[model samples]
Target: MTSHHNAPAEGGTEELSRSLTNRHIQLIAIGGAIGTGLFMGSGKTISVAGPSVILVYMIIGFMLYFVMRAMGELLLSRSGYRNFADFAGDILGPWAAFFTGWTYWFCWIVTGVADVIVIASVYIKFWLPTIPLWIPALVVIALLIVLNLPSVKGFGETEFWFAMIKIVAIVALIVIGLILIFTGFTHNYANGTATASFMNLFTTGGGFFGGEFMGFVMGFQIAVFAFVGIELVGTAAAETKNPEHNLPKAVNAIPIRILLFYVGSLVILMSVVPWQNFSKDESPFVMLFSLAGLGAAAHIVNLVVLTSALSSANSGIYSTSRMVYALATDGDAPRPFAKLTGRKVPRNALFLSGVFLLSSIVLMVFGLDKSTGFSIVTTISSLCFMFVWTIILISYLVYRKRRPMDHETSKFKMPGGLFMPYLVMAFFAFLLWAFTRDPDTLAGLIATPIWFALVGIGYLVLRRNPAHQAARAAHLAKVADEQANARAWQDQQLNASR
Candidate 1:
């Protein structure tokens, strides 16, 4: 571990504090599962896929559940592993770790940038139409960094309340929507009309799969962005209290959360407002409230969404900084990022990520429309996130191949064994093809490789550095020794039991 000299009175440790409790972990997981994408992007998805976007969310959630399970099993398999990147480096190679860590870091940074843009342009302007976009954007960035700078527990708590607001808003929407449906409400639009009832889900416009084949496919382009941070629990493993207990609890409940939060919310929203009535540029939740003549409540929903975007940006800052800190520990990033403050927070890494988030302000200055800017960043984010998710599955497959005994002895085995990873990867490949079907998404798809190319070039340069080589070699050797010891211990335990 790297030590900081001239440490402050409260600063000396080079380790992250495991201060996040079960409540924090559970809420963080909930917050991760529900994102700004669900609140803001769902409008676009409904406009595109009609009623079938419900299925799109279910499919994405189902596949990602397996990914979470795979991650949980891998993290618990070895005590030395910090996050997926650590195991990726150990099982795959140093280059895998370098790519996975940096890619995951970039994933959140891009997502954070989008969140910033949304906060500034869409949500903030919903109230203060006259306010400058950059002012609120910078304020949000500073607030998140300051809150996160105190401790891991602070971030967890901030996320907890943020997640709670989202939960309350969605629950309120669902309850209110159900009431509207039961009372037989009717909405008259300039183009057409819709009735608030469950039947609308099927009889809205084109039926359940209303948009036809291509429309259904196009749904994945935006819906995928909603699930980008689902694996956040995996990243916070090191800072979690009693991860073995909390991690599986969080991962295992994902299915129920999806059914309740994503599927349930959408089902009610569509039932209340009808799929065809949703606007691509507006939030369905806000529309639902507006339809009920609850203009104040609609404004409140918009505020909740503003906070939702802030929550996503906050999570991005927290996770990206930790990833940088992890990379630095492995010598994959700048050494300074490895430094921990008195609270064990990665101050330098946090500041760097916050600085990068300012790019969203620049995008605003360039006068890019909110819809265009959001689509570009989110599409790129979804693609990069897919790359990171693929790395996790690939790492899991290699871990199984190399350590069958560990799999046999594991407590939290992935339900599908060896077949699920391949299945999920195939689904992701289908999503990539789906991305290419839309022009906006296709532009993002085409541009995403530039990021990988840059990372690859950086990795090549770092590989030639003698210091990095030695550090990486030492890290790999250490991982090997730890794995060997773990295997021996397992064997001894089995023998003793016999």
Candidate 2:
């Protein structure tokens, strides 16, 4: 209900409220990283690797853990880190900052659009199961826009509840499944399709081609995608009350999360229902409950996914607005984006990002269903994030060469160090290969070049803006005046001494 349309015609940095607590940061990291994709998409990975899909999650989680470790090392190393983009610029170059800023902005925009589609579909699952997905998708988009248009605290609170719902759902499912595994609870499908009592989860289709080793390896890419948003914790640095203390706690919780959320729920799911029966199109969690004769589980799970979608969208808006703000402050984007309203929120930037978020509504007009529309936008999953990962890796490499002693002495150093980065980079490259293999995501990868090209052209175009030129001149002039004033003050003191 609060309007952001009153932003000043004058543009500059906005001092936003830093009310976010450690609880918010931890939950935001957990919730942002583990999205609907992990809950639903993991089902597909289950079929590929059977029980071994658990390894896929752990492996990718480990690799990313180190990546976050590297980021944390640099971020906490100096208080000067405003955001990751600034760090990239400081270590790499101004161009690195510009590209990272805008690419990250696009990444979140595309991601939020995908989440919007999922939220709409989740709504339709109830009243109008047969109704087109686009109608509900639009409604969900409108609702999140309303949420995001408010102050930062409003978004944080909404995400707090949203994440709590998902946590409860996963916990409940894990508890119920564990009981069945222990007490041998019988279900309708328990006798017919049940592959094995416990080991069926890892039966490995047969031998080499069986769903064990290679299958688990094959699922790594998707599993990695599921954890794509984990680093979102870093993005909240500007809003966090005390980023240093809170960030370490949030990052340290990743291993425990892997154990409980990813491994724990997954093991229970495999135990309750055989991995082979997993339906790629629908969430395996919903299927497990339906098979167990629980009518309410489908609706409950749907609500959880919808909540996840909202969280992802909220994060997307929050992150994209910041990235756009960074770009403008660095002169990579229009100065208008850096402008803020009285609330200290980037209102204009939020509006601009919201327009990109609404692009999903147009996807509906293309005669595509929400899933397909969602699919198109979701293609940025690997490309944009991988680019970020690449930049981070490159930045880390630069950090080591530039400051070897710092690398040797840092407490939060990545385990493998120089050797590990090469491995992580190789892993990232393989994931890209995995992305290329999928037809649904291929177009997004192809389109990445065009987007980068636009950024290149835009950077050059913005270089010539008259207002921008004037702003640059004014900044340089101010710097000169400060220098002249310092000289005159020193001379006046010398004259008094004489």
Candidate 3:
């Protein structure tokens, strides 16, 4: 891969600086891959599909890896393209960019609100059970805002360590569970007793598919949430030091990360404790450690999961701010959001996101049950995230068709060529159908179109503004110039070859 950095700023004034290095980019990618959904939602998935949840996670990860590859190629296709929104606006027109930009902003905001709620009601309650929920909720959002406000480097560093804690926790669980399996450990459950052995995978409980086809199908509904933020590396493209090198390195490792972190961890967990014994309402991570007789297991796992939530909220705040900044600079959002602090941080956008996150406390004030509220928000988030993923694939398809020369010359090309995107899109369509089969997710599915309707309305209105029209025309003109120049260069090379 080529080493492409953002062009240096003329006056070194309000532009986003490329302060994130390879390590920062790598860890941030990891943080995005491993969300609270894996930590907190795994038990539900295990309960739903039994041993088949492993396959469910594998399928989701496998599909998403292609999506990420498509996004990586598009981001690197042109130095002028900052993120997907840039290409979406350039290729799909300004409306696509505006729609995607705002939708992505909303996706993270909803996710952040959910994370804030979980931290306050569930994680904090594990320790300070008597504390008012709103206090912790507000504090979590405030802390994440403060963490991101210092500088982009500070945001990267915070996510780096937060991701490290999650990695260490999962690795520890895998290592300790392996030791138990080798030693033939056994644990008692309400359903039945299970011995710690590889045979537990098939010999105990309902085996794979949880003994029902529908259960396996249901597994996909919950498992999809665990992979929500996998494309966050694409959003960080503009701020990365070397997009061509670091982007590929980070994207290529996704399969290994899924194997070790998601599939591997689930395999080890079930081996130690039979799948039937796992509670949908509780964490399998804590149960395994507690059964293994770690006196502090619950507390330790609680801390890890808490930090996982914090890391997600931190990402939401960081990404949402940048997305707004992108939208504003493109004339798709209010101009104030484009302003940067002396540290080059999007201060106005950051505060606006935090303010939206505060609505989590407002939701709590209505006496919503933690589980129900979190489920609704997360379901909507998963649906919206799928929309974003679908756009990335569509953008890739358009890129390949319209810019075949760029595709041919790309050092990092998407695997599966023209066919894979269509296949992935079909898979996503099936996933949407899968969501409709469940009542909770079905509610989210029905509600999601309303967001699009509003976005469409907003775009229609925004297009009337002369400033928005000028910005759109200028962006398209620039892309046309770049493509024309490329075609001319190709013609010159052909003539010289003769």
Provide the global lDDT of candidate 2 against the true structure: 0.72
Q: Candidate 1, which ten residues in sequence have the lowest lDDT sum?
A: 1-10
**Per-candidate TM-score against the hidden true structure:** 0.93, 0.86, 0.95
Provide the global lDDT of candidate 3 against the true structure. 0.86
Q: Rate the local accuracy (lDDT) of all candidates.
A: 0.86, 0.72, 0.86
Q: What does candidate 2's lDDT look like per residue over 79-179, in tens digits?
A: 64657776776667566777888888888887887777656555455657788766777677667668866777777788888889889988888877877
Clashes of each: 0, 2, 0
Q: Report RMSD for candidate 1.
A: 3.3
Candidate 3 per-residue C-alpha lDDT over 1-498 given as tens digits, one digit per residue, 9 for 90 to 100? 011113232233446978999999999989999888787789998888989889999999999999999999999988867778777777777888888889999999999888888899899999999999999998898899899998999999999999999999999999999999999987777887778988778877767666378788888888888888899988888889988899999999999999999999999998888888888889989998887789998899999999999999999999999999888776678878877888888888999999999998888888764665567777899989998888888888888877878888999999997899889889898888888888878888888899999999999999998868887677667668768976887788799999
lDDT tens digits, residues 95-143, model 1? 8888999999999998888888878887788789999999999998999
